[model samples]
Target: MRRITTVLLDVGGVLLLPSSEVMRAAIGHSGIDTTDEQLRRAHYAATAATDANGGPDRVEVYRRTFAKTCGVPAEFEDAVHDLLTDQFTGYTWQRVAPCAKEGLELLLAKGFRVGVVSNSVGTIEEMLATAEVCQVGGGPCAAVEVIIDSAVVGVRKPDPRIFHIALAEMGADAAETAYVGDTARADVDGARSAGLWPIHLDPYGDCPDPAGDHDHLDRFDRLCDLLTSRSGE
Candidate 1:
């Protein structure tokens, strides 16, 4: 196997983060009385929105579910999407981990092709634009070479095809490429199955790689350490 020349990452939980406070505040502002029951319902709906069956259109998820939870019929898609966006992606993107950004820059400086391969059922481009990550016409693609969004691609992970697409698009061999994400099934196992090195990002101090090698970590600061520790960098 050759040394790695490409690095793939999962966005949402890693980059976007999961903010409970943000969600609570947004739902409270919806005038929908954020009760315990409402909280549980909202969580369920949000989780379902990510899976395969919920079907991508984030506005539909919020419009239908929020309406039911708030006991309202419906609202315009723009209004609903805006509401949901406030809850989920409303975080200040500038506050992202400096270590994460540094690690990315380090990888890029090492001449490694970087990209994002996320499991998203919503319009990722919209989210990217909202987060100030340029997505059109060769703008800021440096952050992540290409985004393989599930909503747009209509395909989820744990599938070899997704990894194959990434490897091909980046012009890198699977043997030399690597994927870093938080999920065990999707990131580690899937990357291994695709013949790429799997680096699980376990923030909770748990290792999910199953090999017990201790490559799992809490932050992206150690990314260079992992990539360079091996034959790849």
Candidate 2:
């Protein structure tokens, strides 16, 4: 509402997603068959479940939710979860979302500063580069103002400190910036607490948000539409 001039993004789920190849391989190894579409749905379902749970055991919640969403039987759930954990512990999260680059380009074209603030394992910058999404400076990918990784910053989200780090680096005021992320607890609540506009990326329409405390977007293109419309106001 304050006229967003800066846009900070989360890496996983927003710009990048878990590698489908890795997911398929893990599922196949577990003797369970699945399709790309199902895997995509499963990822969002897992995130939604984690948001609803809002507990510290997020990894377990995500695993169990993903297994259930993927139609894994009770007996095979643990095995699939373990396999997925082993397969996805590294660079498997680098698969760039389809609309990421275009979305960033649209933001840049509209004269908005862009950056990243993600809860990652210290490799988000490199991973974004590898995925050709964007980076801190000019490159083949969209050039953003900064990238703040929580692991490197020694602060995680739902804590205002992490968002502050990005805001400081970008020299952007919190009220004039928007943080886009997938989960409600980490993204919406965190950004709101940091005094920034929080936009939740709910591609699956899963987040209930009965109180309607923040904005929700079904896709990156919808985000572009929202910002573009706001810019005109």
Per-candidate clashes, comma-separated? 0, 0
Candidate 1's C-alpha runs over 4 A off are: 19-21, 26-98, 133-137, 140-143, 208-214
Among residues 3 or more apart in sequence or in different chains, the pairs in candidate 2 whose N, CA or C atoms overlap within 3 Å are none
**What lDDT is obtained when candidate 1 is compared to the true structure?**
0.61
RMSD (CA, Å), each prediction: 7.9, 1.4
Reference-based lDDT, residue 80, model 2: 83
Query: Least accurate stretch of 10 residues (summed lDDT) in model 1?
Result: 89-98
Error of 2 at 2 (Å): 1.7
TM-score of each: 0.64, 0.95
lDDT of 1 by residue, 148-173 (tens): 87766777777877888877877878
Displacement of residue 105 (Cα, Å) in model 2 is 1.0
Give the top-scoring candidate (TM-score). 2
Off by over 4 Å in 2: 230-232
